[model samples]
Target: MMTHWIKSNSTVFGKYLFVKGLSQKVNSKKFEVGKTVFQSLNGRDLLSFEGYTRNEVYSLLWVATELKNVQQSLRLGKRVGLIWSNPIAKASLTHASQNLESSLCCVHENQLFGSSNNYEMLGRSLASTSDIIFLDVPSWSQSNVEEFAAGSNRPVILISSRDLSPAVVYSELLSFYETYGFLRRVILVYLGPGNNPALNTYFTVFPTIGGHLRYVVDGVIESQASWEKGLRLATKFNTEIKQFEKVDEAIDRAHAISTCSHNLSHMHLKLKDVKEMDLDWTFVQSDSHKGLSVSKDLMKAAGHSLIHEVINNQSWIFQACIAAHTSDYRPIIQPPRFEGVD
Candidate 1:
């Protein structure tokens, strides 16, 4: 088979003529905004996970939060860590708190918050734009290759580019792996619109060597809000909704449901607070837990719970919130001594 290489800059960002031959096209410069000058990668190179455990779910949330802050810092040309005490339900993290900090060049909780920020004058050195965005994905050029090649536990080095054939990417990466063994695997994502079936199916053969954490295209078309399609697909896949492999899609729909539930009561609540407030009054009970009662206080808390236990125990955190707010939002409906957050 004959192979032809073409170089063209994306209209989305016309600063640099990038693509598979970016190293040659932008040979003069070290890095361009969206152009890394490394090499193109297949969409299948993106990492994917089942996300069926609390740890996995928690890690995703934590990573996303950190990535958001990192991206923001880069945009601002600053390198300060964001405070992380309030966004999530407090829980002990195994790999998140440290690994994430190192990855983002962030201050750990103790340094950022527990220690005085207002009192002590602490500042992080600004990172170069390219330092935050692009690098040689195979082995960082600025760093020690021997340190990276020491073991098989090397971290993921994502070099996102499009229009590169899988054979070229796989061959190049495979060469690097055999020589330096720097990256454990390749991670890829497409930034443009519409479905790229060819790119999406890039890693089907090398199942053990790639993933899709950033881009999991489900062919949703122009629809912004729709779970019926996902549900229907779930049925066709011969799997219960709870056991669907597309857990990210399930979580997205769950978020939509919870968002709709907020319309019933503009305010959110805690279960304990709801119970204390309604101690004397009577309300409808959930059919699943009759007599035990469902507190609409915050009808849903999804990400906090694990996947298997959620299905087995029949958790209705979100449903309860919807029911409670839908049923009544009047503060006067309280039974007696029910003090809420001021």
Candidate 2:
């Protein structure tokens, strides 16, 4: 039998070197953090969250949050091209793009990644036509992402949930942290026994921003794997990894709780289990299909406590708009206060 993989680090081998090389290449072309958000983010591929500084992440959240404040058609004349595998990802992004008044030319993963050498031609054509591109293939790894990025000149946002390379899709978590000012205790709950690589993004990000993140695991194997992963991440980030055996206990300590149970529509959170948490405790249902992990009634009870209530598909919209220079307004980026809980 193959040995079970147990440890988690911020990046896979050579990923750091690859990102550094890309950064240097971009810098050679006069690519640096620009005065405005549009200039700063334009013509970049967000393959992974590995190279982003805490300030950059915070600035992005600020930009995305600010995009929702205005009713103006920011992306009116711009066209967005999306290559997506996940149906939920495609639908969520389509909805968000429509709301922003951007025209979309979408290609399914089967059409783009099929057995054909025309990927380069297709990518070039798409890049020429679209202002920005979104790649949401969950199966694509770091190398796959890099290859796509290299083929296209337009900005590429990798929004997939993959093991080898984590996406910036979870930056909505940081946006929540910023919007709430700060939350001392945060709980990340996954419904099933299998390991969700999406959580790796959260593990890497929360530490950089400085916050208490606790993981709640149900299965014995999962708990062990999670504990080992947490240790490795803590060592890598020089922070503490708080793992809890009981969901209710974790919920009790958490000021905010987010769930990543995508397909577990049958599994629901019981009211009695979470009744002890403060009335103001925040709940985030991160899945595109709402109420898959938590019941609709419990979410109703959450009331004002529920945040990012819908799957935040709009982050991609703001990112595309920034890259395409669709907005003229340059909002100030303010850093959030960093706090670590004991």
TM-score per candidate, in order? 0.19, 0.68
Which stretches in model 2 have alpha-carbon errors above 4 Å? 1-39, 70-76, 86-88, 95-101, 116-122, 164-171, 183-194, 218-238, 262-268, 276-280, 304-308, 312-329, 332-342
| Model 2 agreement with the true structure over 60-115: per-residue lDDT tens digits | 55555555554456545568788877666677667666766777788887666456
Query: Residue 109, candidate 1: how far off, in angstroms?
Result: 22
- The candidate that wins on lDDT is 2
Model 1 earns a TM-score of 0.19
Any runs in candidate 1 off by more than 4 Å, and if so which?
Answer: 1-97, 105-232, 239-261, 265-342
Report residue 335 deviation for candidate 1 (angstroms). 49
Give the alpha carbon lDDT tens digit for every residue of 116-221 in model 1. 3331122112122112211112112212222222221212122211211222222222222222322122222222222232232232312222211122233332
Error of 1 at 25 (Å): 50
